[model samples]
Target: MSVLDQTRVDRPSPRPRRLSWTVSDAAVMIDRGMRHTLRNGDALFMSVFLPIMLLLLFVYVFGGAIDVGTGYINYVVPGIILLCAGFGAATTAVGVTNDMTTGIIDRFRSLPIATWTVVLGHVVASMARNLFATGLVLGIAVAIGFRPTASPLDWVGAIAVVALFILMMTWVSVMFGLIAKTADAASGFTFFILFLPYVSSAFVPTDTMPAALHGFAEHQPITPIIETVRGLLMGTPIGNSWWIALLWCAAILLVVVPISSHLFRSRTRV
Candidate 1:
């Protein structure tokens, strides 16, 4: 045989590139994220613990002075649940930032898997973590006298809203993570998220605030979401707040998801 023919015969075939993501790939990434959560004792503890402490603090320490035309525990529990979910989701920023800055992303790029799955994995893990923390907060709230008058359907609606909010916030955190240069910066970026609930109708009625603050609080994204959850859980008047809350979440996801994708590509580009 000619040398050219021999050279052709000896060459290996090219492997097909993974242009699309698979469920299994996403699941593997999710498992990695969950394992990280399990190994990080301090983060897991604080994610669950801080919300519980805040629940106790607000319910016992501040519940007496705050009047929302209901038992303070009942009035405050929805806010606490959102707070728990927000705090849990915020941790995703730190996790994603760590993965980005630690050279693991480069390792993953060498594999045949879709890189976006890494972010998806973090998002799903954050949702799961936040949901678990939210459940614990609800249980504690009930134990501490948070009584809800909602029917089964209302309970379902409330849960759906909470889940949607978690997902939206998780994406936002992912974007922040992608943008931050360090884990500390990522964590710092989420402080705004953690602070948002306090400014809304979470802790008190927005109307009770001064004119300037009340306008901002009532119009901000968090207030409508808190109002929707409160309405679903407590049988309070929701008005148009439910749909408005949904629209807010949808808008945020629409904006952030594409931005996150772009940032991920830019950051990982060789």
Candidate 2:
């Protein structure tokens, strides 16, 4: 064979594509998200600060007015935890919206990578941040007067519920991020999510609410999730609240994930 032909034969071929590449790409995006969080320390500071401030204000200012049979702090801590998680997840919308508007997403599209990796990265980072935020709130609650009778397994279950809830919310946030023209608009979508816990059994009992309000509060997604976390922590009978919460989370993911994916594609089309 000629020298040129021998050189061609010695050259390496391109590697075969594998499904596992998605995981690696997602990790890169996840790292990008973590770096963003670290660079903007204000994000972490605000995320933790708001929840802690709320915990203090509610436990001290309004604790006397709310009655939960047990200490009000203990009763409300679970709800506050959910609130913290929601707040963390809301940042995903802002991040996505900023990227969309700033052309970062367009740059990503030009790369040889799976589209879903970017979304997954945002979600994983958001979940990590939320878990940290919730843990901080729980620690503060414990420092005050909150106590729980939950076992190790119950604690695991509570964590799982919160994580799943965050995942569901992150997808919704992604959709809002894609649809929103401004960061403020994208964030506005989370107002209802942040408010939902209050209307539910988070702050006060549903029975204390008026008839129609009570019905609505009892049926809302936040109620079961809050109740499930509260029940798990308090060692109260969870009954079907955990299952109901899981179902709600699953349903939200089922509906919103596709819509978010579609919106992302439509909006990012070059």
Q: Which model scores highest in lDDT?
A: 1
* Candidate 1, superposed: residue stretches over 4 Å from native: 1-14, 17-21
Relative to the unseen true structure, what is the Cα RMSD of model 2? 5.3
Per residue, candidate 1 scores C-alpha lDDT tens digits across 229-267 of: 999998888999999999999999999999999999998
Positional deviation of 118 in candidate 2, in angstroms? 1.4
Best by TM-score: 1
lDDT values, one for every candidate: 0.88, 0.84
Q: Over the stretch 102-206, how does candidate 2's per-residue lDDT look in tens digits?
A: 978878887667877887888888888888889889988998989998999999999999899889888888888888999889878767667887889888899
Q: TM-scores of all models?
A: 0.92, 0.90
C-alpha RMSD by candidate, in order: 5.8, 5.3
Candidate 1 lDDT for residue 171:
93
